[model samples]
Target: MSTSPQKRKADDLDIELDLDEYVPYVPIKQRREAKFQKLASQRNIPEPQKENEPDDETEELVRAGPKANISLIDQAVEVKKQKLIEDSSKTDIEKKLEEEKAIMEAVAQRKLLASVQELAKGIIYTEPMKTTWRPPRHIRERAQADHDAIRQRYHILVEGEDTPPPIKHFRDMKFPSAILKYLKYKGIHRPTPIQVQGLPVVLAGRDMIGIAFTGSGKTLAFSLPLVMFALEEECKFPLIRGEGPIGMIVCPSRELARQTYEGISSMIDFLVRDGYPKLRHLLCIGGISMSDQQNVLSEGIHIVVATPGRLMDMLEKKKFNLDLCKYLCLDEADRMIDMGFEDDVRNIMSYFTSQRQTLLYSATMPKKIQDFARSALVKPVIVNVGRAGAANLDVIQEVEYVKQEAKIVYLLECLQKTPPPVLIFAENKNDVDDIHEYLLVKGVEAVAIHGGKSQEEREFAIRAFKEYKKDVLVASDVASKGLDFPDIQHVINYDMPKEIENYVHRIGRTGRSGKTGVATTFINMNCSEQILLDLKHLLREAKQRVPPVLEALEDPTEKFKDLSGGCMFCGGLGHRISECPKLDAQRRQQLGNISRGGGGAERGGGEY
Candidate 1:
């Protein structure tokens, strides 16, 4: 075998190959695994374990390692378990929040469905509105002159398309016998100008914008028709519990609401006693128990007389719904809007699911209110009696330049000028209280009323004054707007109101119900020149003597004649829109709101 070198090399290679085959050879993977095990063992590191294995097993594995002091794997497993628990808790919290949100959404949807169902039921009882009532052709032709004469005699100015002719007497409307008798008992022998025209439009079921002087029977004009409408509905389909309020009257003040409530209640009582179906009405105003109002609503209501604030609150709270309400009257609507109830009014209207008969009665018709009326009413009849914002012709307005300090003393003398049953209007509640106390101390039986008084207190004071138990009623503007005191002989302005419109309303309190009365206004240097200038123009327009102080004041209206022809918005002669304090304040408010990241500033701007 060792003879040749090449042959020997070949034989050696063959032998080596055979040896390799026979030898117990380790694979590369096995070799690496062994090497890693050796390295881990030397370093005191434990082998990796499966996630599904028990923590005890992992700890055992770590402990089994030679020279291993602590189990890092066990610590890691414990940390993972804590993280899992934290993750589960977070998931549960999120799930709870989502469930709550879903529940709220479901509740809201259910309420909406319930409202819709109720509205459907309401619509079932609704009757088609009659917008016109024309007499027979022969009668219309024959009585045309008679109608014209009636309108002229009452100073009735009507505007609208296809408006019904004015009715001369209550019987012409063909009211229920009970209502006729009640009116007669109340000494309402004839319809006033507003009643003459307003009755026809309302009975025809047409929307109306009624403008008349204060105490001109506007309340009766609207209330009587409302009662009739409600009665017809009740007779046709009686209301179940929580089913009604077919008619609603919204006033601006609590006193006004109470008055309207009493007025309607009197008529309703008369009708009920005469064997008509019972018609339930509610008086909803602040300073009264909400539970009491809710209780009334639960039984079912046919009519509701309320102020904007409380009415809006009740509607929002779902105490009662306006689904069945078809007739709506807004008494002293301008005052309501002026007192910041416009938004509330609009919100309340949103609850009406169907078209309604809307009546807006006011002593004044500013352009702003006119625009609102246009948007709110559909094809409404506008009945204007005399000039808007004009002083009552029957009022003897006496303007005096009384110093501020002397006003209190002068008030006593003014009281002596007129007999008992005098109304004194002051701008501030504090002033009203002071004047009332002063008059009482001077042996004058006086009572005070303001927004600050409780509902009971205000009612008592108004009642005492109306009954002539109190000689004078010292009140803030709350009593001036639409409160009716039957025989108020005099109205004394303790202080001139900042706005001329208020002055007009203040004087309007006395000269009411076709009776002559006197209004004494006290102005001083503290009074605004703009108001003074407005007073001057109003005096001249009314044919009253204008004091030299007011007459001498420059009329800024001439400067604005080229721009706007005067302050058309508020009917002021001393200012344009540029100088309008109301507009300026509104703009400032809008800007402030915008700066605070509020939207809809443009909406407010467009209102101007």
Candidate 2:
């Protein structure tokens, strides 16, 4: 008998099992028994004597001795069998478990769909079309006259030395043909409208805040000009052989930094071939082993794309020189603030010299962000792609007043009707997990991403979502930031956010660049008056169609309370674990009553 005890597992290594799609073969036990019996029969050497067989040592020895051969047969298994055993020692079995679990998930998804379909048939009603009275010819003429007069007032195109010349062609900028060639290889020969308008302004060393929807090739909009500016500076300072990193791009999230780097990798690679071999790009984000990052930084870099917090930590540790950085791009301007990185961003900005060219881009610009931009940039050449009182006309906004209990029903309907690769945003961490489970149960392919997950888990989830291994992506605010997932065609807000700012960021995930898309939100009793008001304010700002019913719940008070827990009703979360009501209540009760109770409260009462 073996006396050795099994090794324990580490707690942080989240182990999960999935038995979905489990095409199980017969147990190894069956094989063991069959092989043992076959060997016994072969070794028996039957004696064909009549009557009763004599009880002899031969028979006794035969049974026991034959069993010894079974061990040898076990060794005859394939190399793959041995490899699986060996590999198990290095990796946790949780990954395989997850795969198996997916089979169950598929079943659950189907059930969810069926139930949702039934509910959808009842709740989804056709909205009646509004009939408006026709306008008179005089009214139409008056409107045209007013439009012309407003255009004339704003059309006073003053000729100033600071104003950049209108762009005619990409070649006019004179970027190295090698870089241009690389851009062409990536099928990005044409610069975006923002790139055409923003590049010239950025290249002029002017600060700029460009508001454009997602997927408009904003990375190139900021990067191409920054690269050109740096290249020009290098030519002027030829004597200084090795100047440290000249440009830095600060994003709000790791995924964004990663995507941004990929977006500009070929262009940077082309620079390396042009003999400015010192041209090196660095990436810094959470969840990565920092040893290699530190080692690479010791030698220095020409460009660094990083999330704000990690970048701040690297700076405090003096990882590299930042005094020379002359270019900065806040790639996801709105997300940085929404992700609570505004402070980190401001701190990073302080490190760079005021002369650095600053560029900020976001789908929506709020007052807080405007204030930040005003302070951060010089008299910036503000380029607004946004129309007055219009919020991404390309995106269709929808809201559903779903019953609190009928969310699952509504969710199923949305999933079935929505196009594939839809992004579903939840307000809390648990909701991400729960919805991910529900979708899997309903037979819809899906995955979840949150801070609770490790780096590897997050990467795998995104890959599955992007590669169509999954149809829906269930995520918390973690997905709301600078991250980019190109295949996402629809965005569903399962829960409304507390801040109007957050709502803007959430919707911005879709209709990126110039692509048309749709955003749908859940509004019900769970949606508080404050949330409703915030939505109305946003709608008014965007000049969207607002129903008369929306005006009924005019929130008289600002209610961003930073509640102790996510509202159990809506699942909206914005606070830390310590602040949770359930946890707090448990702690309070535990502290109030001693485990021993009054049985030990004898002599001195409660006084010590």
Candidate 3:
């Protein structure tokens, strides 16, 4: 070690440093406490500690209170234990009484729910109620005489027990001031024949089947009542989100639905402006966004005018419910069945949770269809203004024999017979387009609508024609059913419809709202003899001039003397029940369906 300074330093540095033998540094106080604990444990003696010494964290928690440390699990456990102890302490009789009390509460709750449901469903009568209020005997007799005179004057035929007397004017309807004002604004001073009777029956909440000529205020007859009913319902209990349609109107075509929706909307708008509660309505039909309809449904609705197909689709998807629906209208019911929508209508009805006031309106109502409609109603009143399937007396029908090739050329000359607002109806879509194009080429302002066109196009065309922007509106049969075209001076049948009921509907487009109109029909050899015979009889019945071509045809009623006026099944004078083309077609369709393992065909019962 004393040899040299360098040798000494080298010897000190050369000593091996083992990493495994290394230890982390510790404070002196902690090391001493650990050493004392280890020594006490080895000697089997307890180590002394300061009494009542609280750590900082523990002290803070104690200051916070006992609740601070209790976990949710512990609290739940405590509650459960307390409940169990209370339950165990109960006597057998007491437990039985508690159980009985729970059952009674449940029963009471169920009964309350049922009553609420009944209130929401509104009221529908099962049968017509007799008039309880009476005037003096002489006054009653005079009133009866007056009613009979009115009925006879209007050709009003009513079939029901204890039917209400028809009102003489709109003022007799007892409508709200706003409604009366609306009617006055629309230039309606008096009620039409259908409205005279229909208003009373519908306002009374009786089920009814109304058969009147087209364009005879049938829409108002049903729509006004629906408005009143919906108003009453909304006043009683306002519709919540996703709830609605206290009243519904089902049409066979989209155009009709839209028209109805717009009409109701106008009335509603007027009422709302007059300080009435808002009544929301929706138009449910094809060629519209389902999302838009769903959005409207989410906001709730009070009334809905819809076509069968779209309505069925919405019902199937559970977009909205008819739980609150108590008023239903089937406009053009015969046409609906003819279009094979009877099943859809029935299916829609199935969605209703309770009985509803059902109304069936049409220009024609065959007996079979009436019976079928009656099955769904509870003692419905049959109100017929004039004979079923009878042409509108307001319409002057003109029949001409035109060659198929020359019909297009004859159309221009016919349009000249009427003013700017003329309706030309073709049986098919292509013919409508051809007519439209031809008129346009001849520098005539014309618009055309058919099922083949988009909804936007059809609406635009209808709007243009209605506003008098277009002088002529060439359309297919789609425009015939339940479409109210105002000021239509003339209706030209470019092609005769296959069915006579359709012919009546087509002509009905012109003669509307107590206004006289001219209907010019073109018939060629392509038309069936059955239609010709029916047309001849319809012409004769309406006291119109009969074309020589149709007049030359032998009247089938002559051969079947026992068959009385017309085919009782279809109201067609051309054929008896045994020879009815409609029946024969239905039978053939039925056979074909059976052979194909499908359901039977549902045919329209001829015009009412």
Highest-scoring model, TM-score: 3
Summed backbone clashes in each candidate are 0, 25, 3
Residue 182 local lDDT, model 3: 89
Model 1 ranges with Cα > 4 A deviation: 1-128, 131-146, 293-295, 558-566, 589-608
Per-model TM-score versus the true fold: 0.75, 0.60, 0.75
How would you encode candidate 2's per-residue C-alpha lDDT over 1-608 as one tens digit per residue?
64433322332222322344456788886777677678868998443222366566644444345553335455456446877887777533354344434533442221111113333453322221111212234433555456335324433121123444434346655566877777777767666656665665676666777765555666787877666655655565631323457788887666677777776676767777876544456787888877866645666566788877778887888777677887778876755543235445656765654256667887655433455455555566666554311345566787777776778668888876557989999888888898888888878888898777887898798878878888888887777765666656689999887554457667777777557777888887777565576576556555677656676664432243323222221112332222223234434554555564722112110000
**lDDT winner between candidates 1 and 2:** 1
Better of 1 and 2 by TM-score: 1
> TM-score of the candidate numbered 3?
0.75
Put the candidates in lDDT order, highest first. 3, 1, 2
lDDT scores for all predictions?
A: 0.78, 0.61, 0.79
Number of the top lDDT candidate: 3
